[model samples]
Target: MIIEISAGAGSPSEQIRDRVTGLITTGALARGERLPSVRQLAADLQVAPGTVAKAYRSLEADGLVVSRPGSGTRVSDQASSVSPALARAARRLASTGREDGRDLEDVIRVLRAVW
Candidate 1:
């Protein structure tokens, strides 16, 4: 998977995490699709391997991705089970926030307050 991190986005790790999440939610990344290795992705994104690893760890914790010895990481089948409507809404909200020059944390705070 080719992942791009916006220069003005949040931290590298958070940007990676959000990008992967968006890909999964939008069905661009299919269930069980293997993702690039942490080292590979870090090199591609020009970030530290630890940053990519951290993002992968967070995704795994959220049940969006899975990793196994020698198998690398793959999108979890259950990841696609997230409600499409909800995902779309989230993407829209994030886009709106970015357009409004709000950071992700600020958007998250608003979501938390509304939720």
Candidate 2:
């Protein structure tokens, strides 16, 4: 569960948001998988608690994650079905990266360039 914040990425909260979205999209964080508490993520990511809270709140608003009263946050069951295009794109990016020795980031850039 290591999330590395890139120096060239966006703001901390947005970066966290993107990373969490990637986790759900790639199935790394499965439906109903428990996420770290906001305090815990803040400590681990060295970001403010508010930053983590903002990211979690955004995910909740988008229905990608759910907060349980005492059970912590869990990846939403809906995330698995959120976007057909995203799922397909994720799979394609993974396959392209594996077969051609391209990175997923590179694949994304190429896809964007072509389309």
Candidate that would win on TM-score: 1
> What TM-score does model 2 achieve against the real structure?
0.71
lDDT of 1: 0.90
* Per-residue lDDT over 30-113 for candidate 2, one digit per residue giving the tens place of the 0 to 100 score: 899999999999999998999999999999999999997899999998887446677777677779777998866788788789
How would you encode candidate 1's per-residue C-alpha lDDT over 1-115 as one tens digit per residue?
7688887768999989988988888888989999999999999999999999999999999999999989999999788745788778877998999999999789999999998
Q: CA lDDT, every prediction?
A: 0.90, 0.86
Residue 11 in candidate 2 has what lDDT? Answer: 87
Worst lDDT 10-window in candidate 2: 81-90
The candidate that achieves the highest lDDT relative to the unseen native structure:
1
The residue pairs that clash in candidate 2, if any, are none
